[model samples]
Target: MNDECDFCRIVAGEKSAHVLYEDERTVAVLDQHPAVTGHSLVVPRSHEEEVLTIDEATTTAVFETLRCVADALETALDPDGFSVFHTSGPLVGTVEHAHVHLVPRFADDDVTLSLSRDRLDPDDAAELTARVRDAL
Candidate 1:
């Protein structure tokens, strides 16, 4: 963990958060600026700027924490469904540390989380797929 990251401070117990869950590998806490009620963030203990760049064990721990927090949100809030997501890159206002948002969604809520449905050219799709597979 690093000193500069706010999440690291929270993980280190130097800062206060509405902590939902914690273990050796990860921590889950309520989002102060929630999109909806019962919105939470699952963060890994180790400091990594990107989730994809983290080791497999830490990645696994993040997913496990996400599942646990989602289940807890279901039992407590009983939302219609969930919108589990996260933001990345400097263009968006994302925190430096890697985290996953587990947002509890209600059918009546106004918030809409969506992606553009632009059509992808077949050749572009195939090339992109090959590039990703080769990188893996």
Candidate 2:
């Protein structure tokens, strides 16, 4: 286990977390500094720096656990919506582990969508859909 990584420490049972869900492949814990109430982190059991490093089985397990946590969050908090994001760039200060942020948003919440003038056109949207579909 990686001693310096917080998530790794949590998985090793060396640290405490408000864990809502846990399986052989993943663990879901409530965020200490949550943007909104019920915010949580879905993390893989295996330590990996980025999503690209996680194998297919571990990736699938992460999302499966995420879906379960999202459902429970919706039922418990009844948030307006939710956002699932993974930090990709070095500037984001992500830990050397593959994890997903499951943040619940309320109707009057402070969260804002960052959009730009260079938005996708209709053709681009169709192509994007096709590309994403092809991946599945």
Candidate 3:
């Protein structure tokens, strides 16, 4: 664990977080600055800077924790739906630790998650897909 990282502190029992769940590999916590009520974060115990850098086992555990948190939010809050996703880099990854957000959504809430952008042309889409598959 990186001693300088906040999430590392949280995982190491050196910090305070409203922990929701914890297994050997992952921990779920309430977001200190929530976008909506019941918003939670699924974090890997190991301090990987990004989701893709974590091992498969940790990744699986993180996502499994996400699912579990979603279910709990649904059961506890009975929201209209959910907004579950992960973010990295400086733009949205303020925490620096790789984690997934499980947000309980209500129909009346103003929280917006939408993407509107120009669609790729068919040829461009096909080329990108081919390149991605080749890279994989």
lDDT of each: 0.91, 0.88, 0.89
Write one digit per residue (lDDT tens) for candidate 2, span 11-101. 8889999999999999999987888888899988888888767899999999999999999999999888898888876898657777899
- Against the correct fold, how does model 1 do in TM-score? 0.92
**Once superposed on the true structure, which residue ranges of model 2 sit more than 4 Å away at CA?**
120-136
lDDT of 1 by residue, 95-123 (tens): 89999989999989877887689888999
Poorly placed runs, candidate 3 (over 4 Å): none
Candidate with more favorable, higher TM-score: 1 or 2: 1
Q: Which ten residues in a row have the lowest lDDT in candidate 1?
A: 85-94
Rank by TM-score (best first): 3, 1, 2
Sort every candidate by lDDT, greatest first: 1, 3, 2
Instruction: Write model 3 residue lDDT over 1-136, tens digit each, in one string.
Output: 8999888899898999999999999999999899999989888999888997889999989998888888888889999999988887898756788988888989898898888989779999999999999999
How many clashing pairs does model 2 include? 0
Q: Give per-residue lDDT, candidate 3, residue 15.
A: 96
